[model samples]
Target: MTSASEPDGRRQGASAVADVLKALIREVPDFPEPGIQFKDLTPVLADRHGLAVITAAMAEIAEGADLVAGIDARGFLLGGAVAHRLGIGVLAVRKGGKLPPPVHSETYTLEYGTATLEIPADGIDLAGRRVVIIDDVLATGGTLAAARSLLAASGAEVPAAAVVLELPGLGGREKVAPLQVTSLQTV
Candidate 1:
């Protein structure tokens, strides 16, 4: 149960883990677009120790959540790992058109354009369930914010969100204000 604290008293957890992430996270310039440097977590996720540290930290942040909602792609990996660590089920928030009809969807603006996220409208009882959204990175925050809204509309309570990395200059924190966000590292 390793935990670290931010200057604001928010528990970030395990400086050693942060160090590992910082070391392992690969930075590529001009990815997906010009003037955008991408921080790829593939290496980090592939490393056994890196995965363990992140899973533990994220699980701690999502301690009280009944379910973990992972965003469309990369988030699925972290969400599954954290949910497993916490002994909770994971809800896959899919991309638009990925799931069959009768889906709960929310569209949001991305840095480039726009995208939509969806979850099953039926089969899963979201009413009154507590959820924690997990993702690999928090950039513009459009994806996470839309996921939160989608979950809330379905009657699920989103108490908090966790991510491995946060790009503060993007204003994601301000955009998702009022929702507690825990990030293992900020760049």
Candidate 2:
């Protein structure tokens, strides 16, 4: 069990870690399209100390989760590490048509068009399992919202969502209002 002083100490340590991560993040202009500034975390992932800080913070927030539902690609990076730290399994939330069998899906509005995400029904047996949805960025919250719905619809207990960064202008929190949302950095 952690002592009373542990939480504060952890916060201080996590903040230091965030500083290192922030420094490693690269500013990539017009990535995937034009008129968009992307904060690439690839460098952060490459840094051992940065990764340790992030994983520790994630594990702390994931205190009671039975499973970590990682939302495709980048989420897998954070989720895989967090799952290892927490000694839990990871359920992948993938783009539509990617799963092999008995998949469940949810669709949401995208900046251009509608997008769909899928999760295998047997992935995490939602019956009474505690779930934490993780993603790399919370831009419009459409993907994460869909992921959360898919998890809940599949019978998983989704109480919270986690992300490395969140764009407040996009109202990502409102999109996943049914569940608590946490982000390491806000932009």
Candidate 3:
């Protein structure tokens, strides 16, 4: 339904949307802890244009996915929007113990501590589904990697992951090795 040039045009569009996101992100230094500069995307999501831009761009990247997997909190927001755009469903990948028993969980180490991601082991079978993981940011890639594992365990083929922003030094892209991660913006 589109020409080869369409991909390039889409890339340009995504780049422009990323520019919009960069302006709206709030930089908070040393809030939760020392030596951590948190990139808060609340303001970006709150903006009418920001949300529209990101959702569309991410949806484009999520073209072939049958389902969208939203990691914990923020990913829930992006996943809903992107899935809606794609006319598909969004899976809420929750924090450990949030869901009832019989859940599939993958635990990973974080910079501060350890965390786990869980999904229903039953119901809404994810078997053979092509899923794309959406998250707000990619830091250490621990969370993303865990989510990929959880989904793969559920029999879903996680072909790709997308984030609103990616912190370069964290080696997040490398951490989720071979699983393509598309960061709308990097800072």
- Please give, for residues 1-187, the per-residue lDDT of candidate 2 as tens digits: 1111122244445466557768988999998789888899888888887777777776777779999988889888889888888899988889988988787889988979998899877635677789998788888788988888888887788888878788899888888887788787787
lDDT score, residue 77, model 2? 87
* Tens-digit per-residue lDDT, 73-110, candidate 3: 99999999999988999999999999998999999998
User: How many pairs of residues in model 3 come into backbone collision?
Assistant: 0
lDDT of 1 by residue, 109-147 (tens): 986689999999889999999999999888888888999
Evaluate model 3: give its lDDT.
0.87
RMSD after Cα superposition, model 1: 4.3
Score candidate 1 by TM-score against the native. 0.91
Candidate 3 segments whose C-alpha is farther than 4 A from its true place: 1-12
Please state the error at residue 165 of candidate 1 in Å. Answer: 0.4
lDDT (Cα atoms) of all candidates against the true structure: 0.88, 0.79, 0.87
Error of 3 at 79 (Å): 0.3
Count clashing pairs, candidate 2.
Answer: 2
TM-score of 3: 0.91
